[model samples]
Target: MKTRQKNSVQGRTPLVLFLALYQLAGGLVGLGLCLKMIPALQQPSTSTWVGIVLAAVLYTFSILCGFLLFQVTRQAFLFSLANQILQVFSFGVTGLAYNYVAGLKVGVGVDFLTSWVFKLKFSLSSFTFSVGTHTGASFVAVNLLALVLLYLLERAKEAANV
Candidate 1:
């Protein structure tokens, strides 16, 4: 059960942990992917090196965000908000372009939803969002979802205390 503390941040422990873990996994996986690709991506040219560097930096940001989220820090929320704002454009352009943005392919397809469950057809490397493609995303949905959950939990906690 969640308690209504007098004047502390409203937090739902399980949801917070879930959101943290989600981001943490994202960071770790992204970092691991970048690290794994480095050897293959290595080249003697400056331009080639830039790609590797950018990959490292991107993963680093993810790791930092996960860390802040895990700690439930205000900075984490701010950073996440900023990231989302940027991603809005990123996802929109990529989604609309319907092309691979740096080896990522985005597509738009209608999802067929029936009953309460969303039927899924899963593959080893990826799974369909709902047996369709429309408004393809660069995994932005995960971050957005986590942010919403975090905000909702915080609001719930606030309401509990008041």
Candidate 2:
């Protein structure tokens, strides 16, 4: 008897595993955001609701990726692609959503697209730590880099196998 390989693509296992771990990490971050939102839920601000909804979506994608990427199966490739695309877009969309929410809170967005929206109207105090500050953008940038690295690693591994 011989050990059978599913999908006959063992070389692609690293891509699947890396995507799963990355998605799991992102999902954990979403969980953290959700935990933070618990106390704020009492007030139920627009931003808080946005955070909750985004976290839910993130968790769903994370679970899907983690489960599907565990084995080098036929559908693992599709799930890996799904995970990467979701993270990449989620990061960008989350930033925009946060900006929109921040602008609305500060009387700037949707109703009026003013320079104040571009400016950091989130927090004017000495503590430069605000929720809607460029955090979403930074998150998106980080995920994009992860996707690029994943691609490079996959290509290099495939070449090495060849």
Candidate 3:
């Protein structure tokens, strides 16, 4: 019985270690992208580009964080909470930063897809008034759901262990 338990632990060790490494890599990549966009954010003409870059960075980071949380907690409920928090924070920061850098007097709220689709207007005023796409919202919802599922699975694993 002891040998059996030891073998099981050994078998799971690699997977757990891999998950930890993956989480670290994802975090580093996300941080790097965020840093890379900072300089672009300072330039007035490149503000739109900065927005794009920042969105990509935040999205990637959120996904990675979700993955890490899922691996660690194996509880979807907790993961969902973390993901939702990240989504809201990312959206708020990106929205504010874009407006400041682009010199939008009013404010901007363009979605991921629509921003590229509707390029007819280039004025700072026009861009500022743009609304974001549903895709961003959908991403947040999906992540939330995933976290919930993971939480349930984690609970099951605990029960099985007992």
Candidate 4:
């Protein structure tokens, strides 16, 4: 009996695997951040250092994730291109979602603290973070452009392979 080799060209297993791992890591980190933020928000006398540390951890994880994505995708031009494109979309959507969620969380936290911790009548007006609309749109555009470039690169690779 002879063993046959399977084709690796059609199905994007490597890409899928990389994406899954990235999402899993991101999800875990986000969950942890949410948990930390909620507790801090609930405590009226929470230390500013705690907030700073949490922000730093979130930033570090974000940077690490970007590096990991780049490392994983660099192995294949096609995958890299696709990822570069998808990253833009992902970032924009994630940013918007984060903004909305964070705002809600802050409001809830303030309310919880006022009612439970402080036992004072307090009304919080606004909570703001640095995410901007222009930034998200720019990221989306860049990703779309990268996808186009990746398509060209893949085509070139195919031609070369032939």
Best candidate per lDDT, number?
2
- lDDT per model vs. reference: 0.42, 0.44, 0.37, 0.35
**Candidate 1: segments with Cα more than 4 A from true spot:** 1-12, 42-44, 89-162
Candidate 2, residues 61-127, lDDT tens digits: the string is: 6666656556544465555555445433212232243211100111111212222222222211000
Candidate 1 per-residue lDDT, tens place, 1-162, comes to 233232224542565555555555655665676577667754446644654565556556655765665545555655644533332222222323211111121222223233233222221111121212354433322223334544754554344333
Model 1 pairs in collision: 108-133, 108-134, 108-135, 109-133, 109-134
Largest TM-score belongs to which candidate?
Answer: 1
TM-score of 2: 0.49
Extract clashing residue pairs from model 4: none
Q: Write the per-residue lDDT of candidate 3 for residues 17-97, one digit (tens) a residue.
A: 443344344445545555575576655555466555555554455455445443443342244334333422112222232
Between prediction 3 and prediction 4, the one with superior lDDT is: 3
Distance from true position, residue 102, model 2, in Å?
A: 22
lDDT of 2 at 127: 9
Instruction: Pick the winner on TM-score between candidates 1 and 2.
Output: 1
For 69-130, candidate 4 gives per-residue lDDT tens digits of: 33333334444344334333221332331211110111111112124332222121111233
Task: For each candidate in turn, give its C-alpha RMSD to the true structure in angstroms.
Answer: 9.6, 9.8, 11.8, 15.5
For candidate 2, which ten residues in a row score worst on lDDT?
99-108
Error of 1 at 140 (Å): 14
- lDDT for model 1, on a 0 to 1 scale? 0.42
